[model samples]
Target: MNLKDKAKLLPQSPGIYIMRDSLNNIIYVGKSKNLRKRVYSYFIKSNNVTSKVEKLMKNIKDFQYICTDTELEALLLECTFIKYIKPQYNRLMKNYERYVYIQIDIEDQYPIIKLSSEIIEDNSLYYGPFINYNRIFKFLEGLNEILPLIKCNNYLKEKITCINYAMGKCEGPCIKNVSSKEYKKHINKVINFFHGEKDLIKELEKFMKEYSETLEFEKAKIFKDYIDVFNSVFKEYKHILRLNNYNKFIIIDYIKNSIFKVIFINNHNIEYVDTINMNNMDKKDLEEYFKNIYFKFYLINNKESKNIVTKEFIDYVHIIFSY
Candidate 1:
């Protein structure tokens, strides 16, 4: 069938579309709340399509789409497909490998915190894939003042001492001054601080005030920069922490004749994701199925759970509540 005919048959629901070229190569991938409307918009000559889209349309031969239950699901699926397929016309979020993560080996006798660009399947706690490495490192450095952890690579060694110990910036794990248990307590505190259990902003404010009182303008300026960086990165960290409070929940929605389930667990971890086709079920049945599952998993009466749900899925819920 021609592109126009195929587009006409598209379901007016949230989904992702894959556009192919004459040789059947996947060239473009996109998502839309209304697949039929979005796909047809491309074929409209009067539509103000960008130069990139115009060029893409010229090579398009055929297309495919995976229906999703919600626009959020469609958005997430589009990102996954784009990353895996590496479509020619998709330009954003392709270089996910370049993103950085802060890795801490909690299993180690004396855990060391460091930056990582990849999340290996080690039992370590990984903090971020933050694009701003300098800001993150600076924030860590500032955090060290409030909650001191080891800053040296050669920790837990016998008869070795570092300058950090002399400066009182780190507990002396090198000289057997800090026991593994004692050091682990500090490490746990650092973890808690990262999880938003403690307010580092207050510490920053105190340090800034001291610097200014001592007439150390240089140090004051440095703290000011740290404050800015921390505030910027903390927003994302705060969101993840909120999601972590909910032990488990399933986000269910219907696209066409299929049900999509995205199960989030262990705080912000994605436990399971799948789509089930139920061609026999109608829209009313789908809504009933979703409500049954949602109420079973979601504790609406619990005030804390509601707050966590509100903060965690604020973006998705805002769109839903507004409608």
Candidate 2:
């Protein structure tokens, strides 16, 4: 249909509108507050792209739309539809479908834990869709550190706790040193941690106070450690502007298995161009995290080996802590 003909049929509601070419192929998927206004904006002379859109518009014949409840809904629906169709000319907006998040099935009878891009179970809660493996590993590690979660088994009652708990690294929930109810409470703390609410600090303080009053100094210390972790983590790293470098180059790298990301600052703007591998550190060490994560991500992405991640290089990354 012609522009004038198409304008009359468009609605005033929020929705996703698809523009088609002469061959009836979807060229673009767009969303807006008002379908009519959005579609009209595309038809205007200035709205036409000087380069690619010129060719697309010349081949345009008809279009389609799906109505949504609200503008934000329209925007979300548009993104979903775009991912589904992956229309041409929207190359920059191509979907990020690679990352998967670790979800804890808290509401289930056995609580099946797994990695997922989207949580399909309405019964369970999703912890993250973390794009980085290092982050995911830290999350699982942190979860294990504070909570009574069983990392080795699906069902808590299946078997006895592992050697970690025997060595004081765990709380021994698998053999029932901790109850399901208490485990659930720890899971709630994990939820609070993920939320990263300011009130979480307050709640942590309150919980610490209660534990101290009850003479549970060990438990209070655990909470204090976690609080310190949150503080140090928030302070040492950031994504926004920084004073470390004039270039303020941000190095964002993700490890493959977990939701780990490290934001490093450098005077140089170079990225994946230079490899700063840091993969030798063990999983339990907190000090070597940034190095371990960066190295694994670098190696995984580039298909390199640990020999490339030298001890001297690890020391260099550690020096940044002093800076």
Give the number of the best model, judged by TM-score.
Answer: 1
Question: Candidate 2: misplaced stretches above 4 Å?
Answer: 1-23, 30-84, 88-141, 154-163, 191-323
For residues 117-141, write the lDDT of model 1, one tens digit per residue. Answer: 7667789988765655677788788
Across 157-216, the per-residue lDDT of candidate 2 in tens digits comes to 557667777767656666667666765775676565554544455666777898999999
> How well does model 1 score by local distance difference test?
0.71
Residue 83 lDDT, candidate 2, scale 0-100: 59
Q: What does the lDDT read for residue 65 in candidate 2?
A: 86
Q: If scored against the real structure, what TM-score would every candidate get?
A: 0.61, 0.35
Deviation of model 1 at 21, angstroms: 4.0
> Candidate 2 clash total?
12
Q: What is the lDDT of residue 66 in candidate 2?
A: 88
